[model samples]
Target chain A: MTTESVRVAVAQTVPEFGAVDRNRRRTLEIVRKNADADLVVLPELATTGYVFESESELADLAEPRDGETASAWAEAAAETGTWIVGGVAERAGASYYNSALVVSPDGLEGVYRKVHPWNEEKRWFAAGSDLPVFETPFGRLGVQICNDQWFPEATITQARAGADLIAVPTNWVPNPDGDGRPGDWTAGVHQAVAHADANRVWIACADRAGTERGTAFEGQSVVVAPDGVPAAGPAPADGEHVLAVDCDLARARDKSLTPRDDALADRRPEVYDLG
Target chain B: MTTESVRVAVAQTVPEFGAVDRNRRRTLEIVRKNADADLVVLPELATTGYVFESESELADLAEPRDGETASAWAEAAAETGTWIVGGVAERAGASYYNSALVVSPDGLEGVYRKVHPWNEEKRWFAAGSDLPVFETPFGRLGVQICNDQWFPEATITQARAGADLIAVPTNWVPNPDGDGRPGDWTAGVHQAVAHADANRVWIACADRAGTERGTAFEGQSVVVAPDGVPAAGPAPADGEHVLAVDCDLARARDKSLTPRDDALADRRPEVYDLG
Candidate 1:
């Protein structure tokens, strides 16, 4: 039921606006470089850049699960014998949803739509209705997109659903209101660490670099251990990076924190009213 | 309904084991020092040092809400004309619970028992039944103990209940499994920051310093703003200090993150299923 350890890689790339074909080629290049990776992750909307000027531009760029975005990732996964999970601008019928696609060597394993869309994303895409965790050779995989990280419930739900690693494909931008201070409170890394510490889970956050149109992103991809320690890179804030980590995936399932404490088992759910 | 800005204080101290009388005296000294603070916070099991060997030891130290612990803190509050929230080892009838008490200039306001007790506290203390938010001159106040901070629902519930600040009285110990990295994931400060970021509420975490028996406590007490900024002192890891910050309590009620985003108002509760 387990692969013991997983050699994971995160490809942090900033896609050019509306350049779908060029982005797909660039993705393949990075995937090939990390040929030894068991699991590969990329930034959100990696095929098409974020920040749409209008609905027409979004409609033009968005593709379905079976489209070029999925096909390219599937080809890479099958060729390299790696599992790929990342975000895409998904088209369904007449509507589009921000989605995370899980692709294995076999093909597309599953897709989880971004449950909580960021600011203008509400205008471009419909909100997702379900949280999905896909089964893999290593363990169970839970996926989330940008802005979804802000909601603590998203991680809690996935952790409760038995996710071994929560893959985060994000296009993180600097907070306009954030007054940068030298402490745990001011950094984006805290959010991942908080959830990982509380849930006793592993988290891999792959964030894009460079600016899209007028919007700039913070690139700090990392693989966090169950102990809430960053097992790998936060990458450079402005550089393209291929972050890698060799992790014992089984640690995510072991909730025992102290000799007497089990993080999930010790929880008093009856007293908590999330509704 | 709004008090312009409230000056808050957090007293971080390490109590000597089996020295309740000296601890009480020490508590009064710190309360008198922060006479200008509108609200003050102290650490969990503030009087009785943690790391007990047996139930009999806990039984011997546990006091009633109106016992010496309350009266001493109450006397200080009355003299200072300030409100105080702190943790205590409470004995209700024959049962003991790790509790948070709200004391104002008038008298004892309310008590919130620690719902989620960490490690051996479970064996000694009865679990809490409710999460209470008390109204004060500054704003609504929510209270929690050490291990309770690990749960996001604790903060979310308080934030929804109109809590302006969550006063955390924590006897924080070093992570038994911590690798000592330079990032934010392993620290208790990050958890507060994450919840503060997500809920857009102020958090006052008063952690103790120094070692008790074989266990070491990490100090660094902080007052986090709604934007997840440490508005005050994280004190120091090895020293006993009082941390204070002047904050506009009105910001807690205003969850607006961006022009179109109100952090709490944007939560789609229907989609989130923690179970």
Candidate 2:
């Protein structure tokens, strides 16, 4: 394994609902704060926050892929010489999509829409079909938004497509009993770790913190290693933080669990009834 | 969602390497002790033990699906009126397969050969081609062994085939660094939880305890609910313990995470590149 490592950062910020401009500026500020990182990931809906009351409000907040938020993030990425993946509310013709934009130092490299929308998201955003693996200077990067993390297929697709790391931009809500322990590797974190371990790929989740319109967000932004260990923070349950960790792409590329077992190659697809 | 629940028990007993007779007796004893449980699960290769030395040794220890061990288990199940799921090394004619038998009061209901054998198991056991979901009075039961848990498709296939609970008879070897935490929800446990949460199906992992031939096994046998919480478990890392939990098949049946999201229905199979 080569000693090729990259400093990845997850910016756990509190985004106010419907405040697209403010949220965009706040995301840029978070990026600027962690300027030294090779890659920085922001929470889902970083440009417009989550929990909308009306379709009109959602339509008002949603922007195109090349909107002000992406433009500012692209500018910030150019300035810091770091790649960024952050979620946004996208306006495409008559439909809207919950999407994450991959911005490199050059510009907006790619866009990945949320494949599996959660709860109220169904009413607002159209589900995405493509799981893209974007080529980067450090490694091959993949992106998924919030609820998409719940589906193993999303990560499996990207990992098989040759992604060294998958960036998750999430706005994790508390469990029904309000027992979403962000401090511990609870449900959300466990899913991330399992995905990383099963796929033999690194996963970095950047989750938002704070209550927005009666709904509270669980902010345990973490960077998980291929061995299913959290390399970075579980941050705080309800506080904004920048969790950064040095990730070696070589470790992810080497999928061998043992001399005889390679995680991806070992999969018996012929026997698998995936449908 | 029906109000049907089953008491499931995971027997975390240490099986000595190559001690086929003793292992078989120990498994029967564990089952007899947990006779009150509607369903009981035992560790992988509970009859033959793991970490085989030679082909001849494996052949000598391996029995047919209807061999002595299965017969004993069937007798025990008939006596106790408890359904049982336990791993074994099966000798089908000249071929050896790593398999688990589903024994009811009637007899050996079904046999599931481990589809994904771990490490050196490849040399001795031929991987199976099918993922079976067996029918029981309490619920639909599915079986997978140890390393098969590493593949989500194993559980996904069984769940898709209409399994209420997936029984994982595991011989969890410690990580290379000897850091497989049995108390905490580490890699293996996280996988169980994630599988339960993702599929909205119950997962009972019966992992073995103690060292066998210088290779240590992590116990921490667990019963995970559909919401991804450990319903019972994470038994002592190196101790022989029977961890039991009441599992409501109705909870698994109700796949709805929210008012809008149903786990199984939400799966975007059309978009998944699961090749």
Supply the DockQ value of model 1: 0.64
Return the top candidate by DockQ: 1
Assess each model's interface with DockQ, reporting 2 decimals per model.
Answer: 0.64, 0.61
Candidate 1 CAPRI grade:
medium
iRMSD per model? 2.1, 2.9
Q: Please, what is the whole-model Cα lDDT of each candidate in the order they appear?
A: 0.84, 0.86
What is the iRMSD of the candidate numbered 1? 2.1
TM-score of chain A of each: 0.96, 0.96
lDDT of 2 by residue, A120-234 (tens): 9898888898888999989999998877888888888898999999999999987663233223554678788888888889999999999998998889888888888788877
| Residue B96, candidate 1: alpha-carbon lDDT | 91
Candidate 2 has which clashing residue pairs, if any? none
Worst 10-residue lDDT window for candidate 1 chain B reads B178-187
Q: Residues A1-275, candidate 1: write the lDDT tens digits.
A: 23878988988898898998898788888888888999889988888888888999988999998888788889999999989988889999999988888999998888889988888988898989887888998988889887777888888888889998999998888876766444322256678877888888889988889988889888878888888778887778787898888878788888888788888886777777677
State the lDDT of candidate 2 residue by residue for B48-90, as single tens digits.
Answer: 7888989999988888899898799999999998999999989
